[model samples]
Target: MTGLVIVGHGTRSAAGVEQFAALVERVRRRGDLGDVEGGFIELSRPPLTDAVGALVARGHRALVALPLVLTGAGHGKGDIPAAMAREQQRHPGLSYRYGRPLGPHPLLHDALEQRIDAALTGASTAGADAGTGLSGADAGTKLSGADRAGTWVALIGRGSTDPDANAEVAKVARLLWEGRGYAGVEPGFISLAQPSVPAVLERLRRLGARRIVVAPYFLFAGVLPDRIVAQSAEFAAAHPDLDVRVAEVIGDCDALADLVRERYAEALGGDIRMNCDTCAYRVLMPGFADKVGRPQRPHDHPDDPVDHHHHHGHDHHHDHDHGSVAVVGGGPGPDDLITVRGRALLDAADVVVVDRLAPQGLLAGLRPDVLVVDAAKVPRGPSMAQETINAALVSHAKAGRRVVRLKGGDPYVFGRGHEEVQACTAAGVPVTVVPGVSSALAAPALAGVPVTHRGVAHDVTVVSGHLPPGHPDSLVDWAALARARGTVVLLMAVDTIAKIASVLIEHGRAPQTPVLAVQDAGLPEQRSVSARLDEIGASAAREGIRPPAVFVVGPVVALPTTGPTV
Candidate 1:
């Protein structure tokens, strides 16, 4: 049976050291692995070599090394691996498989939510009533249902010099905010990064949050966690009108132990999928180009037995390639609807060129330093020329910066995505496209109008309505579409719907054919206007339905409602 070694970046705090040991014990108690040991790479007791030796003494030669970290920072990506390599030199015939860092995992998110809930519960019990002269958790009570919704969260992370690692914290903040009902969740760092604990709390206050909870996104009690608590308390003391509470760090819990075991299993099974797209040692980030292809070295530990005098004369060279561009679909309106590949590209991007109808909420979660070019082409209003937009993408890619052109719905569904691709190809820039959920189908479906129904409608046709029925540049066959006994979905046709409707009716189409116009589909402001084919234009105009809308025409639109009205 293979043993497991839980590697941690050792801390000065005895409590943290104890907690790490406790977690190892918890994992050992599961009895799934042969032997389990926990050790630190630096600062604390039981160095990595000692842990390896202990497992070897227990007759376990093969081992799995798992990093007890929340993100892929310098420690996980460099220090721990280098230290493990040194162990091989010390012990002959010893082998180990390395695991990825512990998080951005669902289990960690669940743990964070539990901690936040506990803090809120504890705050209520402690009479954390604003302006009541009672501060902290001195007086015990529970918060009402209303108070829960009014509460905002400030998640604090141990900041890193690596921008990728720092961005992970912001991603965690966004993940915590999703679905979990709170006023909002903001990311802050204890050090190295922007938006310090105090600054985040102040921003929350400025945003009109009356009750705020500071949730430390740490695995155990450490100096950084303690600093987070102190900063939160200081912020609370300064603002008597606000109810503030600090959640405990994720300590030695079964959930965390299970997560460690999962990582161990993954390492043993060779299922590790470490995120290298944004790794500073691989990607060419703005100020971190020097880090790319840099060799890893173990950090000096105070408790290490070795004196550690080594010389570096190795000449390592790597060819840096120019960056590429991705034309990604942002789905309809909600950021969650974006494809996984598209989201990943966005996360790795140095610059994002966004369209008017793209999911704008995603921009909020991007790294603070990412450049966002607004290429919004508002119909009959202000617009950015396509030539200028194409130039921006090529220029950014040529400058060795990852660029993403974020468009709404599917990039190919009348999104002019191919035009951008051609332009990039002509400019000798590498370009790829990520498909998205098109609003043409999503809008009608979201509005409870199916584009096609069995027997009722056997076919569905999607058309662009940018021009009226008889325009010189229009290519849509209105008469042919009218004769078809199927669904006809119209995109970019809100303004020309009146003339288009007349032409359809003048042909073989019935005036009473059911029609549904859905605006801002898949979004909070989404709403629909329904009427007969003949009256759809007037109905939509009367309802003030605007662009970024989808119009569905067919007997399928008359089907019984199967979803929410919006």
Candidate 2:
């Protein structure tokens, strides 16, 4: 049988859960759904993972996970899908399709309109706004100037870090105002990003709005909704005869229940809807032009050509889990060079699968609860197997653990990060990538050797030296690199530095070209040794240079850090 999983952004308020559950029950009463269950993204019982387990226990091999959100914000686009995908990974034979959020859907508009009408009716019946024609039950009843003259609405959204989601709130506010008889609809946020309630209220007043209805765009009553109501009360108290009223949340209405069924059906029928025409990946737009035509593969159909690397029996622990992988680049072996966001994610990670190349100091400083898996890959040496590492990631995430793939340097730059991403995605796992400072550029700069200089070098080509220049597996075009009158940066070339230098010299590079090698770049034990191209290999051997070193080969290496810091 097919299952319907409703995922809500959980709240601490018990009333919020009761309202959400009532809606879930309303949907379940529909004869079309089988084994319907609801869960929260955070802070509540029957989390997304448990919701899946409930359906699985009821003999549901196929399920549809629907998001109960108003917009495609972080929760809708990332967290909910990630949690669902990770849960899917746990139940191998089980297949599921994810549905988008309830919002921006026409039915949502209808429900919100209903809430507005109910608020207006209550005020009208109570004779609060006596002269205001907004008192009538008939929505189409023409409003007098006294009614529309200073009437406006302030929509309260749980403002998000995602700009697009916040913009949607503003857009919906405008859509709700069109021919709806209210003076205007002002958009405001309950918290986080953007126009606060007080600010939006003040703005509305400036725009000639006298009477206002503060409507929270939340699906259920929660602490946020309570705060919205409290804020409205405070504002009303501050302004005498303001005629400000707080509307109930978008509660258990027929429209909302119907929309949940619609989303579920859409997921089953593959009729998922979101604003995709303007997606940055599809069309080149300002500030996002570079992402043009990139393959945006979120949903993996059974028909997709894939290579699955993971296999497991009914190793049953229907535990609370959401499988996700964060591939983070730890940067040139230093904890300090890690980005602020990277550090935050690291601190929040439950399991950190680290590479041998990542900063060892950071590992020592990690929270004691963090389970560290050493995926330490050594150049031509013993290390964690790539397949096993991929499996470990899947395993931990399926067990409802957050896994961070911590590597040295930028994950995509010869770090085989793309492979990890492919692995996780193929296994129906969600992956997040965080780029770090590559040794290719950092090694050169920290050693006072600029890879690119205006008058000295026009380009900088980063190449891997894991294989010698003549080795068939080596992808570096030594001949082209040698002929180019620019800096050539080499990483993982310590063992083959001599042969690589010889190949470049043979391929037309000047034997007198200066070469500078920086070992353990960015580390306290950093060492920079310089020699001519012809003598670098011998000099490195004499200095007993090791792997995890970067070499800069070009005329720019001849320049010193003589220029002061900009």
Candidate 3:
């Protein structure tokens, strides 16, 4: 009898395990396969050992290992294959094959349709319908075959670093966006990647899409998906002009069972005879002779052999358990201004990995031999890519060097340090971050402008100036920012000064409201400009002053300057 093994990336949540188990059982009840079993590679499990052991004990000779992953990366590409290889070795008599992940499945489209129907129906009950009177029939349209010709769908997934995984999501997105008859399809990620859900939604809305459905391509309902739902609500609320709906996550369905069965069949060799002597099954038969009825293979299996050179064509001698590197933020160009903890790390750094903004004065007192690298960069021009910087930090730290990934300001605040931290952690290189003063607050103070001074401003908001164009956080509630009864400071926005000012002015920030641009602040090249919010762009353009520039806007900025003593 053929055995089907469904594997999941085990989670700590018991509820998640129960869901997986229930899914497996439901598929089993359909009587599609001879035997159905579930296994986990990590966390909760009837681990692979037990799952395969049970199947082998049941006299199953052919087995299929179906990875319940949304994409083929990390676990799907490497770990699952490794586990299956181990299982194959242990049960040499069993012929097992692994299958592709259940991504871009049409059933996922069905789940999306159901979710949209539920949302719209709930909306109608709440009296939010616009009289399009889109019933279930209108709401639940699939982007398949001819119906997809002009159709476009935005398929959003939780982003992964594995290129293959992202490629799979992108492939599915292309099918929905370009293949279908709809207007277009877009692939985006909730985190760890770009074309964030909000950006994708906005783009689709602007595409003159009379009807736009925001399909979430997630396998489970977790924090990220919940966040996407909440964001969808906010997005729809913001754009009452657009018809938007958030779809449900991919759930248990008969299609998933079919996918598992397909995997099983593939493992058993779809075109080749299952009982042929040249089969992989010969390894299990051992002394049965007939040369195991297969080709005389080399003694070394390349997949299992250890190679000193890694797949990346780089020399890697680091152990798997290297401690994380230390990425400390030095704040915006100050030595003593750095947090005491950040300073300590700076002093102790074996390799003072500085960005363009790390004050040289701070590094002056450091050990001369300490390695210092310039990773600081800007966008749209010559600068280091985030991916490159992250790799360098992880690689150096893995080599047992104390790395200080010193950023210009607060590491967590738009510094891209989170990306670095994730890369390091994924590579088994530990990381610790120390906070520093962000220019958002400091620049205003240095210019005799208080973000909040009683009766001058009540609310203070600090926003990044150079958020990537397609960033999820780039969409500001400009009206909210404009209505700030207090001070507003924008950091690193030299390039966006014109646009930021325009948005504010349009949203009720008075054209006459005083705004100050502090350039190269806290250093010798420091310069300051005071202009009305409307004229700030003109002033910046005239001065030809670029970043690292901060914009301070508020009535407090109109306060009389106390000279350079400020």
Candidate 4:
């Protein structure tokens, strides 16, 4: 006789553990196998050892260890297998085979799509129907065409230390949005990664999402997904007009149950097919090639392992005080576009002072207790006061908190990051600056208009158009810039583009020079406006382009498929 053991990355939450246990029970009730049991790799109750001993006692010689995780990450490929190896040494007579992680599979994708549909429909007709969950034709019927056009779906993954695992969730999000007609699907993380749910939700609001749904990629209800739910509520409360809803976790659904059984069958027959394509060791992933083929080494001290079976298990490695401020550039608009160093700092920070233009999707996935300071006040007139933002950075640093001042684009590229850096220095606070992909170049490139192209332009100049052409406070040499032979990328020039274009034309710059304006830069809602230098302002006005946009002037603006022509 053979027995099946379902191995889960156990959690501290009793409810979470119960959910996994219930899933195991559901699989057993189906009654297709002889003997079945559930166990944990770590943290929560009955360990895998207990499950193995019990099964062997129940007169079983062969067993299968099925890892119930979304990716073949450390837990799936290393930890679980290592633990199983230990058990194998203990029971020489018993034989067991390991199965693959449960993800990148079509069934998993189907479950996520179903979760999205249920969330959208449930919110649309919540109070009207009691106990109705996407029945019959309602499952296929979209909530509303208007809502569908404006809604954004945010998929929250239990972020992993392995970058490949973290990236898989993003791929899943993109695939879900490819053919579906929702406004967009954004990738978010719940733990150990960027683009937190709240950040993504706020970003969706800024990108004009009429309603947003946050769907967790967890196979069971756990602490991380619970935090995602709370973050959604917090964001909804903050922005009363924005409708935020959380979809169900991939619970003990039939699809997941079927997936578990399939893995069991595979493990029993010695047919484990691991995902090698995304494996860092086999594939040359940018920064992880050195990790290739390294044998799994155990680091858990048995006492201070990752899981503690208690609520206080997740302490974010802040035993020492980092009484300094890290000025992190968030890159253009996309969450994943930010550099790896910048993201790592965000995950470890105790206080994150963020700008409106920062990669907001990263915020939604932060630890539930991390203090997030909204620093988007307008510098001069409306919005958050820059003085206040500077004061917050200085104060937070002085208070001995690990502070991360997150800004959009390069900190020095018209982001006012230098001013904040200077303020911290003046306040006797240590500061470190992490460079990021500036919107100036990122926006243009994302729009298919590189600032400089081979044989098209040799040099590129980036200038802030916030002060207009002839403002006394402006330091830019308009006439000199007009004479340049390369591309000119302008930021903060939306309102004053007409004057700037006029000044360039007056300064002997070509009136017919190609111009491209990219709004909402690297996001899915990004729109491009293209026109000759003389008519760009009119074209921008006609197309309703907004600020935080970049305008590219020169032949490179014509590099992309002409955008929306004037």
User: lDDT tens string, model 4, 1-566?
Assistant: 47888888777667777778888888999999668888776566667777777898898878888888998777787877777777777778777878888887888888777777777666332211211231122333445676567668888998764668888899889888877788899998876567878778878888987677788898776667778878787778787776677778777667888898888878777787776887865665653433356466322323333342222123323211225688999999899988887887787676899988999999997878789998785545457778998898877775556688999898988878899888887765667788999988888878877677799899999998988988999999999999887999999998899999999999889999999889998787888888999999999999999877899999877665654322
For each candidate, give its TM-score against the true structure: 0.53, 0.53, 0.45, 0.51
lDDT of 3 by residue, 201-221 (tens): 888777776455666786544
For lDDT, the strongest prediction is 1
* Candidate 1 C-alpha lDDT tens digits along 497-557: 9998999999989999999888899888888888998999899999999988999999988
Choose 1 or 2, whichever is better by lDDT. 1
lDDT of each: 0.83, 0.76, 0.66, 0.77
TM-score, candidate number 3 = 0.45
> Sorted on lDDT, highest at the top, how do the candidates line up?
1, 4, 2, 3
The C-alpha stretches of model 1 lying farther than 4 A from their native spots are 123-134, 137-145, 309-566
lDDT of 4: 0.77
RMSD values, in order shown: 16.3, 13.0, 23.2, 16.9
lDDT of 2 by residue, 289-395 (tens): 22344332222212222243432222323232344688888888778887655676676577899998887788777777779998987767788888999899988
Better of 3 and 4 by TM-score: 4
Candidate 2 regions with alpha-carbon error over 4 angstroms: 123-149, 277-566
Pull out the clashing pairs in model 1: 124-141, 125-140, 125-141, 126-139, 126-140
